[model samples]
Target: MRVADVGEFGLIERVTSRLTYGPATLLGPGDDAAVIAAPDARVAASTDVLVEGRHFRRDWGSARDIGHRAAAANLADIAAMGGTPTALLVALCMPPELEQSWAEELADGLAAEAATVGASVVGGDMSSSPTLTIAVTALGDLGGRPPVTRSGARPGDVLALAGRTGYAAAGLTVLSRGFRTPRLLVEAYRRPEVPYAAGPQAAGLGATSMIDVSDGLVADLGHVARASGVAIDVRRDAFEVPPQMRDAAQALGADPYAWMLGGGEDHALAATFPPGVDLPPPWRPIGLVAAGSGVTVDGKPYTGSAGWDHFR
Candidate 1:
């Protein structure tokens, strides 16, 4: 049925009925809270919210994109803590005019993406709203290891990152400039592909502190700096934005540096490690851990937008 032709609950019924749950599920769906097990590991939890206009644009993305993104965002946060995602509890709010089919498709997308990280959606809540909103709470297990948080980088540690940056911001620039959304850029904007393996990799390699670069490389690393009580430095000349990004920036007449330095939501893994710890390939070393209390790019103070804020 068309999106405008169906109401919400009807769509939810269709989606939930189709899932193939795993053996790990103690309780699945139809519950106020789903029970899960992490008998041998510590449970790590994280939550995130996406508002209609602030977080997504329906005109630029499908219902599937929204579901995938909302789930991915929460899961990445859990991963940043050096945990493996176990399950998710989703809450959704939608306007009365929304099609039930849209919600069903969204659920399908969420379920599929969660499965990619070995996670399942065991329960959820729904309500009517003036516009679409999504809240996802993700739970993970630390596998007998302590959480790798945002406060451990020490002097002389190596600063590195796994995964690409600037693609989403460049995508946004293309959309705002009245150009057709490039398929890659549109996908980047819709569902940021997080390096789910990087978090555990960092933990295994004895990373001192780690954080996901959701809010640009420089800005998010600053979060690590402030939290760890150390200074971080990033080398701009060593930075590389993908070719597609350079082309997109040219098309939009914008500086790719701004996006690379300040763009958010790419969900890359950034961490600091002591000497001789072998960082896996593509977790490119960007700079060194310094002896101060903030992050600097190219050995100097970076003067630009740090990242997003609730009130700008």
Candidate 2:
């Protein structure tokens, strides 16, 4: 039967029946809001959207890859909040002619990503539109700790990062060139496995300020800088980014430096810490917070044209 026959609510009801609610779920999928049991007293939440053509190409990525990308994007937001991803809410809009198998594969990909992040798809909605759009909202529980917001960095705080950057930019370049996707970049573009564990670890280990690197390194930290009322400086050569980036970038006549500094969608973690905060093992030091407001990279302002913002 067609979706027109079942309708929106009917479809939701149909899909909702397949889920198994656990005891941790204070409230499941029926009301205007889902009441979660974060009695620990802090909730970390984030949302993001992916649009057809802008975020992905149907010609290049499978429906499953699309779903994985969308889910990873949302989960990364949660990780940036320094919270454990407890659950997710997804909303999908697409053209009428999109195939049923496509949706199912997309669902599989979404499920796989959420599971990897230790989150479940608690609830979501489906609708029909002229073009494909995905909106995902991720919720996490801080388990009684105060959230590490973009503010709160002190002048002496060391800037640190967890997870890879610039790989997605490289991946996009590969996709654009009709190359048979580089493994690392394609993996990055398909599903950026945000370092979920680092968020809570950073929070527990005494992080001062935090944000996910959705926008470029400089741009995301700029949010922290403006929020914390401090200047931030990033040492570009600090992190060993993917080498495939150089080759892919040169192939496209793109600057790997620009890609490293400005290309986003990496969903890497960036946070500040007081001197000797006993940071998590794998996290790397990349910059520092200073007594001013703004961001400097390797001691200079990054003048690239591509940090994230709609219609920019």
Best by TM-score: 1
Query: 1-312, model 1: which lDDT tens digit per residue?
Result: 643455445555666796656555788887666888885656899988889888888776788888888888888888888888888888888887777777887887788778888888888888788878889999888877889999999999999888777877877777767665677876887788889888887888898999888778888998999988899989987677677887887877778888988898888889999977787775778889978888888888988788888556
Q: lDDT of each structure?
A: 0.82, 0.78
Cα error, residue 305 of model 1, in Å, equals: 1.5
Clashing pairs in 1: 3-99
Candidate 1, residue 149: CA error in Å?
0.4
Top-lDDT structure, candidate number: 1
Write model 2 residue lDDT over 94-113, tens digit each, in one string. 67676655666676677677
lDDT value for candidate 2? Answer: 0.78
lDDT of 1 at 233: 89
| Candidate 1 C-alpha error for residue 12, in Å | 3.6
TM-score of each: 0.94, 0.91
Query: What residue runs in model 1 are displaced by over 4 Å at the alpha carbon?
Result: 1-11
